[model samples]
Structures are given as C-alpha cells and as structure tokens.
Target chain A: MNTETIQSAIHPNQNHPNRNRPPLCFVRHAVWPPPRWGIALETPPGVGMKNWSNEFIGVDWGTTNLRAYRIGCDGGIQESFEDVLGVSAVSDGNFAGIVRELRETLGNLPMLLSGMIGSSIGWRTTPYVAAPASLEDIAAKITWVEPRWTGLLPGISVLTNSRADVMRGEEVQLLGYQSEHGLTQYTICHPGTHTKWAKVRGGKVEDFRSVMTGEQFSLLKEHSLLKAMMHGRVEPDRSFLEAVETGWSGVELTAELFTVRANVLLSRLPECRAASTVSGLLIGMDLRTGLRLAGHDLIVVLGDPALVRLYTAAIEHIGKDCEPAEGATAFVAGMTRIKEMIQ
Target chain B: MNTETIQSAIHPNQNHPNRNRPPLCFVRHAVWPPPRWGIALETPPGVGMKNWSNEFIGVDWGTTNLRAYRIGCDGGIQESFEDVLGVSAVSDGNFAGIVRELRETLGNLPMLLSGMIGSSIGWRTTPYVAAPASLEDIAAKITWVEPRWTGLLPGISVLTNSRADVMRGEEVQLLGYQSEHGLTQYTICHPGTHTKWAKVRGGKVEDFRSVMTGEQFSLLKEHSLLKAMMHGRVEPDRSFLEAVETGWSGVELTAELFTVRANVLLSRLPECRAASTVSGLLIGMDLRTGLRLAGHDLIVVLGDPALVRLYTAAIEHIGKDCEPAEGATAFVAGMTRIKEMIQ
Candidate 1:
C-alpha cells in the first residue's frame, strides 16, 4: 500500500514527496488532444500494455444531471458526455453499473465525482467537512467507495451563529479558483438555484452564506401574486435598477414585495418591468449581505452568463468591483486541482 | 331627484333631520327595526300593499361571493343568504339584475354593498377614501352605482411614506370595531390572505400597513422546497411557538427561510413540525412589523377564528394585548355606523 499525497500543482515551493510524479487529470472546457497537456493514446483499451495509456475522469454529478469528462494523462480533456440521470433520479440503485459502463467505454480511468452525488440521495452520503477547510482538508476526506475505481468528494459545511449552512460541488470550484490564484483572500460567489457567497482566506474557505434568492425568484415569478404581473423576460430594466437600490437600502424583503403588486395595481407599473424589478430586488438583497461579508476584497462571480451579468451590473451599481467566471469551467478547474492533491 | 341616505339605526344622540321622515334603507351587515329608529312602512308597490314589509339588506359583496343580510326596519338580521358569484364572476355585467332578483325575493329592499364589489373589477369602480379618514369620510365617498338597488361602500387607501396601500372590505370591518368602541385609539389587525394593521385614533383609521403573511406561507408550504417538510396539520404547535419567537427577533426573513429546509435535512426537525414552524415564523414576523407601527394600544384582531387565534397567540407572545373580533359581525356594525352618518 504505497499511498502519498500529491503536492501543489501551482506552487513548486510547497513540496510533497509525490510532487514529481506525473499528475492525475480531471478535464473540462478544453477540446480533445489540445497538445499542451494532452497525451494521445497510441492504442485502444485492452490493447497491449506497451501502447496503452491510463487516464483519469472527473464527474460533476448534481441534482439535475451528471456530466463526465474524460481527461488524457496530460490533464487535457479527451472527450466529454452527460447523463440526465442525476442523483435525484437514480432510483434503481444501479450507480455502480452506470459508472461501470462509462469506465469501460473510457478505458477504466480512475474517477473522482463531486456535487449531489455525495448527498443523502446520491450513491453514498459523504459527511461534510466543517469550514475553515483547505483543499488538502477536503481532498483528505474524499470517500473512497466500495468500487476501487471511484472517489467521492465531500461537501463543505459552515456553522454561522448556530445556523448550519452547507454547499456541495461549489467548494471544489472555490478550490480551483484558489489553486489558480494561490493563498489569497477573495469572495467567490456561485449563483444558481441556491446562491452561495464564500470567503477564501489563505487558500481555505473561512465561512460562507447561502441565500435562497434564485429559488424565491423562481417561485414568485411562477406561483405568487406577482406571477400575473410578470409578462416579459426577467431582464434587468429601469425598474430592476430601482428595485436593486431599494433592496440595497436594508428594507425588509417581505414588506417591499407587497409594494411590487400594489404598484402594478395602483400605479399601473408595466407587468414586464415588475418581473425585472423582482429579480433585481432578490439579487440585490443577496449582494447586500454577501458584499458586507466579502468586505473590500476581489469578488469573483461564477454562474451562467445571464445570471452573472445581472450580479455584475448590480455589483457595479453599488460602486463595487466584480469579475465573472463561467460556472462549468470553474467546476472543471476545481475538480482538476483536487485530483492533483490526491494523485 | 329624490336622494337621501339611510338614517342611523344605532346612534341615539346623533339626530337626523330625516328621523321623522320615512328612511330609505341601504343595508349591509347591520340589523335594523330597532324600536327607537324603526318607522312604519308605507303602502307597498303593486297589488295588495297590506302584508309586504320592505326590509333593508346588507350585502357583503366581496371578490369571491355575495353575502346578503335582510334586515327588518327595526335593527336585526332577519335572514341571510350567500351567492358564489363574486365581483370577478359577474363578467356578463348583470350586477343590477343579480341585485334586483335578491331585492325582489327579500321584498324590494335597498342594499349597501362593501368589499371588492366597489373595486375597478366590481360592478362600479368606487374611488378609495384616503386614510387618516373618519367613518364620515368613507361614508361620503361611497359610490351610488347605476343600479338603483345598491350603494357601494368605498375602500380605504393609505399612503405610508409615499407607498400606496389600499383595503376594501377590511376597512368596513375596522370601522365596525371603531363604532362599537366609540373612537378610542386601538391597533386593529385583520388577518387574511393579506393581513392589515391599522392605527385607529378617535373614530378614524390614521394609517395602516398591509403584510402578505398568509399568502407567502401558502406559497412556501405548497410550492417551495419546504413543501416536502410540511406534512401533518399546520395548526400551531410547540414548534410554532418557538418559530414565532425566532421570527420576532428581527432576523432577515429571506436568510432565515433557508434554514427551514436545512434544519430538516441536518437536524432532523420533524416534517409535521416544520409546517407549524413556518406558519409561526411568518405570523410572528408580521406581528413584529405590524405591532411596531400599531403602537402600544389595544390590539383588535378581526378575521377567521383559526387565523385570529394565530395572530392572538403571536401578539400575546410579545407581552401585548389582542382582542379577537369576527370579521362578519364587524362589517355589519361598521356599515350600520356609516348608514347613520350618511342619514
């Protein structure tokens, strides 16, 4: 049993005994065989050992879908595919079989999976690592399942004033950002159905907060009194800007929400504008709390382009700075960094 | 050209010059035929004028239904009936015909309608009476619709810091409480889909605030993530009390809401208990904001028994006093007072 931790891929000074070994790969974004870090296989799987090359795979298995990336030995993506059978949908308990098929097709690569795959509903429930956790802390806690070919990453949990908060998958992305920019403090925001604002200090997640802004926005737009008033696309309009300012003013969100409907009924505020206004208010409120915690540090937003744009605009509106990163790209980069740590 | 308001059936000191004259009746929740105010009926229209005693009818015509209260000349509810055809349902513009049929069945009675029946979607759009408005102010603004059979009571509108707030049916109920108590200062809380807290001073609603507690609770329980955790009866339990206290602590609601789901997942909070906790949190938050604006005074809660109980429990939880009043009874009393003033 020769097991050793792989040292920092970014910093050669922070040495580990296994640092000189060829690193394991977890790929994303990059095209297949991108010469820089890609090794082309000279033979097919089960071929003669002289020509075969062992690879690594990264899986972002979330509540809605499972995305698998096959990385060449040199850390570049060779191919990628996705299965719609997310953790929530895999009811037949055939997770091993599903992974087996993929592994066979991709030459039996060693795999690391992140996101809801480790949730209670996933293949195995991996206990969360309490915050003030570094990438090494997370990588050490990875649950090596019964299947020797797979490793599952644990989610991060933070206890703020006795209120428990947890996030899966995003923790990996945060580590990726940290690996790319070493041992520095930054506010990493991953916005989606449940948006998280995490503080990274000295390459560890100090603490974070989760706001139900995205979920509430969806519920209100689809099932609330404001639903009928939401006519056009939920883009940031003039009303959206005004609402953002209103939210930033420390107003109670519940109280202010009633006024949205009242304004539509009494002031004849256009329905389309009302929808945008709601989005602005929710996003603005999240930012208000998030930015306060973030302080005057670099704020990096990772999410869909449309959502990221909204947050960026709101951030600048309040005289703050923000950088946008694609969520999928960050997920892959984060997975790659973690793979290097366990290699 | 012969137009006159109905004479007071309750006020003894306030003399109407038309007291001796035959008083035309426009009834609502109020009972009539009191010995002091009752007048002998004149000859009835058409065939034999002998046994036909024209009654006053009080119609609580709201958004969902039409509640007609037929009263004797003296001050008493003779009989009451409800029609499911609400303001929204009367799309054929047969409001007059509807009222006419009811009037004929009850002996050609004059009707006083209140609630959403006077809104833009109602039979006639009655303008709202601005707040800090007395019963007299509201009475003066009542619109006499084209249908000779009905008088629509105007809803009250309040502008708080330039935010427009309006209440149709609840205002009448608040006045009913005021008329019964004779214009003392009190905080009147009417709980429903949209809960209202009004500041009443000397027979007038000075100002008020509307909180959408009930509707939000419904949306969260049925449509949001908490829906799964919201099993069992939603009645107040120990969890409800605890949640109410949590809500009254002035925590940001949006942030706290996420915990309702997280607690069930992490802490194993009972699914049934989660429902009551959510209710308590919502009600408690409303009371916190509502009571602060209501000031230190007698709090009158007027609504359904179940809802009123929740509000009463929450109000008392904070060491405050709350008096529960049935909504229907108050509306009748309020209408009686308004009828007296107009007369």
Candidate 2:
C-alpha cells in the first residue's frame, strides 16, 4: 500500500526484465479459437475454424501430484490427464526417469511445470518475482536446464511467513487470467489437496493462502473412523448443503463434531443423510471462515467445478456471490500467459 | 422398539462376548495391574499408609495409541507411561515386533490390559459376548497370560444402521465407572483421536459411536495447506468453539473445504488468528454436530476432567448442559466393578 511496502513486495532479484530463464517447465495442450490472426488463410478440409487459436497444453507437475491439460490456444480444452505418480516419485536426483515417464505419451513439446516440481528439489529453484511482478519478470527469470538426459524445471518459491513452498505452475494460472481477463485486480482459488487462494492486481499476484481441504477429506473419508458412519458415495443431501452454509459462517469441527455420526447412527435423521451432513460441516465451515473475512470479494475459483459449487453454494447461502474458473482452461491460459510474457 | 428390532439388537453373535484367541504374536511390554489395583498407592515412608501392601496396574492399549498406569491396590497413582503407538502400526500380522520395542522398560509384572489391546491385533482378540453379558461375563472372561505377556479383555462392538466398529478400552472405562459408582443407563465419553461416546444401561455398554475429531484436527493442523500458513506453536484457541457455535447446523465438512486457509493467507484475517479461526471452525462444527445428536445422553465423560471440560464447554456454548467426569474415580471403581463381577 505504501512505497516501502510496495518495494518489499517487489523483490530485487525478480525485477530484472532481461533475466534469462525458461519461464517454467512449460507443459500444455491447447485447442485454439476457430481461427487466429497469425495463421495461413486456408482452413483444412477436416479441421474446424476459429478466431485467434486458443488451444494450448498445460501440466501442473506438483510435488505430490501431476495434472496435465490439453487446451485450445485460446484456452479451450480438448483433453486432460492425471496419474497418482507425482514429483515425489522423482527421488535421488534421477529426474531423467521422471521426464521419460511423464513425456512418454506426448512427443517432445514445450511443457510448463508448476508447484514443487519447480522447487530446488524437483528440478531447480526458479527464483520467484515478488508481488507487482509482471509476467515478463517471472518468465525472464526461468532457469532452463538441458538435462544431460532430460531436464525437469523446478518451480519458483516465494520466501515469506518463514515457510518454504513453490508455486511454479500456479503462476502460469495467474498469468493466464491476467492476459485473458485483462488483469487489474482479482482473487483466484486453485483447490486440491492443499488449495491455494491467491489475489492478483495489475498482472501481479499480491498475496495467497493454502488450505488442506482435499487431503483432509481423503483421510477422513478413507482412513478415519467417521468413514463408516456415511454411505460410500458423496450424497447431494440437504444436510450437506446446511454444512456448507455453516462453513461459510466460520464453524470449526472438533471432538464435539462426533455428533454428526451419532445422529445418523441413531436414525434421528434419515440413514442416508449422515455422510452429507459430515461433508457439509467441513465445507460449510471453510466457506464461513472465508466469508467472515473475505466478504464478497469478486473471486475466481480454479479447481474442480463440483468443489467450486460447494464453495459457491456456501457463499450464496449466506448471500455472497462467486464465479468458477474452468480448471483446464485456466491451466492452458496460465501457460500461454507465461509464454506471452517471456517471448 | 419392536420384538424383531430388539431381537436383532440382542443377537447372540452380536452380543456374545469375545474369548481369548491364540495370539498371532505377543506384546512387547509386560503390562500388569498388581493385585492391589495397578495405581501407585505407596504412602510416604514417614507419613501414613505403611499399611498398604498390594499393587495394581491398569493399562489402556487401544487401536491407535497406548497409555499405562501403575497404581497401588488402594488405587493411588504410582507411575505412568504413554506412546503414540497403536494397532494401526501393524497393518498386517506384524504386531509382535512393535510390542517388543514399547514394553522393554517395565522389567516384568502382573498387568491388566483393557481396550483394543484385547482386540485381535493387540494382545489377543477376546471373543465378543452377547448383550446381557454381565460384569461377571467380562471379568470371568479376562484371559490371564504369561508374566511377560499382557492379559487382554475383549470389548463389545455394536452393529447398527449399517455401521460396524469396535471400541477397546472405553468399555473398561465404562465398566470401571459402573464398578466405582453404581449406575444404570448413564452416558460415558472417552475423548481422543477416535472419541467414543458410549451408552451404558444397567451395568453394560450397550452401544457407542467413534468420532474422528483428534485425527481430523491433527491432519488439518499438520499436513494440510494449513501447515504452510502456520508458525511453530499452536494454542487450543477458542476459535474451534466459535466455529462450532457459528458453523452451519445441518451440514458436514467432507465435501468442499479449502477456502478457510485461502481467506487467511490473503490476509483476510491476521495470521495470529488463522489457526484459532480454523480450529474454531472445525471444533465448532464438531461441537454442534455432537450436541445435535447422541451425546446429550452423555452423562459422564470418563477421562481427565480437562477433557470433560473441553467437550462440555463446547456443548454449553450451544445452550446444552454437560457434566465433566474429572477425578470421579472411575478406574478403581471400574476395577472394583469388574472384580466384583468376577467374584
């Protein structure tokens, strides 16, 4: 907000526009617009047409997971891929094995890597451009490495809050939104095991936070005692919605939470209603906390729509408004934005 | 309840008590309750009680963690030990190796083990007894073993509304309560990672439900995206209580729940308060859920008063009345009850 604060937000290392880095371990698959400004005049007999090719490819190679996208240049998607194998599998500096495994299906093409794969552990630490950084500043600082075998670029990590973390591919998501939406200021949320909610202004990400909603859900659903209390499937129950409403209002679940299961077990509620009740409690609590502080910020959530719906519905239940960013499109757009900024 | 329903609830196989099974392996420690009562009861040499002679020890070895006590026959505290080890450590039949490590300290002594240590995986799986199985059924069935091996007692497991789970040690806590305090149809709660809220009727634990509060809390605090946002130490912030009071009433948390951290990280709230807010959201939701359902029947939470206070306080926030089972002498009483039943 002030000169000193702004200066601090814009770190010295990332400001050099001329820094020579590979932007990121770029990975994307795209589907373009019907036509593009920079293409040959004739349309192929078998192919469709569009304005400004939007198709692009994206891969969010995080520390624990790998998400790949196939998109049009304008960020329309054609296909997507996911596998349990993550960068964590890349142990003992044998990144070549990982590169071979990841790229085996796709021909050699520019891939954008994000998350921890961009950390010093994954490939190499690409320095992060602090807040107020331009797409150019970020891309220009990419550290390109030609693997004597195959090179995997590590994502960049921002050091603050005394914690170490990398947001390699997410930066691409930020860049893409800036380019497509004409970035001035907006809030973006990318949900997963550890969901990252970020704020960007002037093509720069001002701040961010991470939540472990996905991981918690998985553990509770699979490993915890509460799992048996609910039916196997995620029910679209009314109780579920009520929980979302609670999360939107900022509820915390603790030992006292055991009652959801007890109620279901008691048949005090419909037998099928309990699992949804538990889920609603978790999601509702999340939304409530956010709404209490976030308060109707025009935000774009970049995650699965089902997940987005949970958040959006929770917010709306409490009279707040929200929109969802198509996860795949954001992935491609993010990579494209980085390319535009760098090249 | 109809005759059929009552018959199902009292099914002999379901109600039948467990018998000692030849262990797949042995316990690592020599856990024994002295003839006295397992609690330390030696009077100061200069003080009184040069009169007491017998020694007793009570050990709670459950599915996930283990805690032990050495008490004098008079039921006075002597020594205590604990470890994070639980049945989960052995996914397969590998329980013997693990026990070896934890039990090396206490040379050897007579011990009384309760909870899951009597489970199939703990010391030995005592068979299940049908309902109407009295204290005599339990104490008579207590499997005495070799000096170095732990003698375990089987617990009652309830199958209802399509839910199946076993509670090891809390059964003993309930028994101890009945032994020490004469009661019928009182509620008992043992709070932990998987907290068990039991319904006891006329000196028998009829049914109980396990809540994953502690596990969920640890997961949210340590492994989730929350870990990135936090500094080292964490206080038992009332945010947990607040979240419960404020969280949506009917909803569950299993669905979508990442926004809490996102709101905090974007500095929507101060970092100092994020943990509490998160805690409150989770615990608050939990409290409401617990109160809305079965725990109202919870007359006595049979553990330290602190746990009783924590659980009861949350319920009070929602205008529910609760009593803590602190220092009520349930253990020795439970021992007495079981001993009398055996006699």
Candidate 3:
C-alpha cells in the first residue's frame, strides 16, 4: 500500500507530506544483510513480499497504544499501523488473537514486540536485563513465543541500594537514539506517561531513572481539586515559565502544587493559565532531578513534539543545553538494528 | 438526649468515654459571660434549651463531611451530629435545606458555620480574611447569610509576591489551638487531605502553606499505575520509615515516587509494604517542607488521631519536636471563642 493508506489509517485527520506516494515496489536482493531464512518466490510482488526472512514487523506495544512498523531489508519503514490495542486492553489474555490480527494486516513476517507486552500482564512474561545493558544484550535475551511468529524484547532494570527503576518500550527508543547518533556517552530522555532518563557510557545503558511527571499531571487534571482551576490549553506561557522557575528553584513539589489552587483562589492566577502553570511546575521538578542525574552530559529529549517543545523550553529556561529528537524515529532505528542482529 | 445518643449519631462504632452519662443540667448564670439576647426560660430544660441566645450551633462543614456541634454557654459541646453531607454533596446548592435539618436536630440556635461552608460552593460565598489574621479579625468578618439563623466564618488568605495560600475551616483550628494553649508564637500542622502548616505569632496566623500529601496519596492509591502494587495496610513500619527517611532527605518526590512501582516490579519490595512505602515517601517530603517552614518553633499537629499518629511519628523520626493535639477539640474551642465575640 501507499504512504497515504497507512498514514490515513493511523492519523485520519492530519495531513501527511508523503500523502499520495506510489505503493512501494521491491526488486530481488535489494539491499545488504542477505535473507537468512528460506525465500518463497510465489508470493505477490508489491502488495505482499515473498522473502519474509529479510522483513520484520516491529511492534511497540505499550500500556495505552500500539505502533507497528514494517521494516524492509534496507533498514527502512516500508509501511506502518497504529492502534489503541495496548496490553491493558487485552483483558482476556487474548494477546494471541491480537497478534494473529496484526499478521493478517502487516503480512506474516516475524514480529518483535516491546514495551509492557513483555511484562507479566503481556502475552508472555519476559525477564528484565539488568543495567548496564546494550542493544546486543537485549537482542540476545529475546523470548520467542511462537518461534517464528512472535518474539518479545526484554525490558531493562536498574536496582541500587537507594532506588530501583525499570522500563520496557522506551529502551528501544533509547537504544535507537544511541545507535543512530553513534554516541558513546550522553543522556537520553524519553518523555511520556513515565518519563525516563538514561545515561549511556561505552555504548551501554549504564543506569536510568523514571519520573511520573506526565502521569501525575494527568491525575491532577482529571481527579484532584486542582482540576476545577485547570482550564484552557497548556502552552509554554509566562505563567508556565514562572512556575518552572519556581519549581527549578528547589521548592517542595507537593507544597508548590497547592499554590496552583491557592493562586487561583487569591486571584493571582487566572483560570486560563492554570493548566500551563501545572505543567511547568511538574516539568520543572522533573528537570531538576533529570539535570542532577544527567550531570554534564548533553540531554537528548525524544517524545511527542508538543512535550518535546515544553521540555526543551524548560531546559533552556534553566540555562541547560538540550537537543530534541523524534521518539518514533528512534524506535524504528533501534528495531532495525535489533532485526539485523537476529539469527 | 444524652452523650451516647449524640456519640452514636456521630461515630457509631467507636466507644465514647462519657457514654450513657446522665442528661446535662444547666444552672442560670453559671459561666463568666452573661446571656447576650432574650432569655425565654420557657422551653424544656435538659432536652432543648429555651434560650438559644446564650448558645449556638458550631458547624464545621467541609468538602466531604459535615460536623455540627451544639455548643453550650459554658464553652462545651452539649450535643453533636455528623454526616457525609459536605459542600460537594450539595450539588444543587441546597445548603439551606441541610442547615434547616441541622437546626431541627441541634436546636433553633443561631448557627456559625466554618470550613468549606464559607467557600464559593458552600451555603454562602464568604470572602477570605487576609493574614495575618487573628480570631478577632475572623470574628469581625463573619458573613451573615441569615442574621438570625446562620453566620458563615470567613476563611483566611495569605498572598505574597512568591506564592499564595488559602484555607477555609483550618483557620478556626489554628486559632483555636493558639487560644487554647495561650501561646504567642508557635507552628501548627493540621494534617488532612490538604495538610495546612501555619505560623502562629502573637495569637494571629502570621502566614501558612498547604501540602497535598494526603490527597496525592489517595490519588496515587486509587488512580495511578502505582495503584496495582499498593495493597494492604499503610502503617509506620520499617518500609514506611525508610521511605520517609528518603523523602525527608529531600529527594525529588516525583522521581522517588516511581520507586514504589519499580521496587515492586524488581522483587525488591513486597506488595504489603507498597502502601506504607508510598505513605512514608509523601509524608517525608511533606515533613521536609513543614520542618523548614516551622524553623525552631515547636510544631503542634492537630487532626484525626490516625493521621496525627503518622505525622507525629514522621516528625519525631526526623529528631524534631512535635506535639499532637485533637482537631475536633481545637475546632470546638475556636468556635466557642468566636461565639463569645458575637455581642
């Protein structure tokens, strides 16, 4: 199928740049890293590929959403699909049924799943590789469910005397960013519901920490008394920056959070500014810890563009240098690197 | 008609000290302050007093609960009634109906309502008296919804260049504690859903701050991803104390909070310890701020016995001096003091 077909199915409203591009056409033995498995020449040409050995489906199955990428032999995304069928939605443990459906849509290529799909609640219980872990270390520990049908990427865990932290799907993005940039030492920040900050050294993830800033922000907006005052869109406005300054100044978070409501009540903060104020306060605190952990390493932030913009702004506001990257792109690159290592 | 009747109406399960005590007998002019209004001396003596002018109903109407105290002329609680009908429960703004019912049970005494009842959503939208507020300041700002039937105590607001904080019913408790102890300078911590820490100097609330520790703990327990691992009772156990120490050490709360889930996933922490661990972390962070604000002054914690126990333990664990006081007693004392000012 063409790019429009895939983009439309995933994001129906957004206009795509490659919207009307011709369907992908493949030639025999197109790129390097020759097919490892037996090649079938009888399958259709462009609609479906014959050599499934050189092609793989990378599924980033997280708690709330699933993103699948069809990687060609050239280490590029030929097509993609997105759905909200995450692990939490598989309440009946029918992960097999979901995988079967994915095969029907993305072709019967060997699938590699990451994220919470590797946890106990996912299709199969996969173990966590301890830090400092590398792309090779993670690929070596892949747990195959149906041998050729599905394989689950192991998550990464860091346990210390002071704290313990773990991540599943974000590891791929982190590794992808590291491999793509060819960086031997740098801090990678993947912001999401659980924002992860990982330190890389000697091409391995030495250690990391997770901050629940995004999730807590959602919780406060949806459930807390602060919900009443948190109206309007959360943009990086003056109020947001001011709140970020306050947060970065080392004020207590829980106490400062109360000021969101207090400011509204005292007529110091308007309702429209409340949401951004809350966002800035949380991000500022998250950055406070993140900067301390990063310590002299350049922070590479990868996530949704809106979140990236806010984080980048906060980082700069604190007079720190931060580079923005695309999380989806990193995931694809990481998956491509791992696919090459498999068998 | 007796203590048991009132105690059972309020707390049906807890044993009361004065249970089954004989009905109260009143002698005229027994207290220092004489009656201010008309003296009927016509109604039933012990069951319902004839003169409501010397007596008043003190109602602490909050967000989630309503507590009514039939305060006698001797500055004592003759009878009390409590229900889950807080301001939030009055969705249709039928606060008058609730007050009418409270009057029917507690007597036709003019009522003085404190807490969220003075908030925007309560019976009347009462203005907040600006700090530093004294009992006299709050008494003078009482908003009369119905001059003869109901009066709403003004909440307190502290506005500065850096931050702003407001409290509804807590001002009563703070002032009550100050007046009861006859202290000129001290710090008071009233811990609850929104824990309020106020500095009482010269018998006035100099300034105050609020931390949403209890509310955030409840939110994390009920709504966040951490909810899955948070099971069993949350006591001040070893896990709780350890988490508290970490929190008190000034770790970034959001980052450290994620350890609740991470520790569970890595098998480092058991499921039973999750609840207490989360509590200790939040409390520890709260105490870190509370202690900083309290400085060298003794912190008097007043609230529910269970919450007081936790705060007391956390405070002492940090090697700081803290005294536990009864919140209901403070509320009653403050109400009595305010009632006496209504000439």
Per-model DockQ against the true two-chain complex: 0.39, 0.16, 0.64
TM-score of chain A of 3: 0.85
For candidate 3, what's the RMSD? 7.8
Q: What C-alpha lDDT, on a 0 to 100 scale, does residue A97 get in candidate 2?
A: 46
TM-score of chain A of 2: 0.71
Higher lDDT: candidate 2 or 3? 3
Model 2 CA lDDT for position A78:
53
Ranking by lDDT: 3, 1, 2
lDDT of 1: 0.71
> What would the per-residue lDDT of candidate 1 be over residues A14-109, giving only the tens digit for each residue?
333333544433333544323322323333233232221445778888876667777655656676655445666556656776676555444456
Which candidate gets the maximum DockQ versus the true structure?
3
lDDT of each: 0.71, 0.53, 0.80
Task: Give candidate 3 misplaced runs (Cα > 4 Å).
Answer: A1-52, B1-53
The TM-scores that each candidate's chain B achieves against the reference are 0.78, 0.69, 0.85
Candidate achieving higher TM-score, 1 or 3:
3
| Residue B117 of model 1, lDDT score | 79
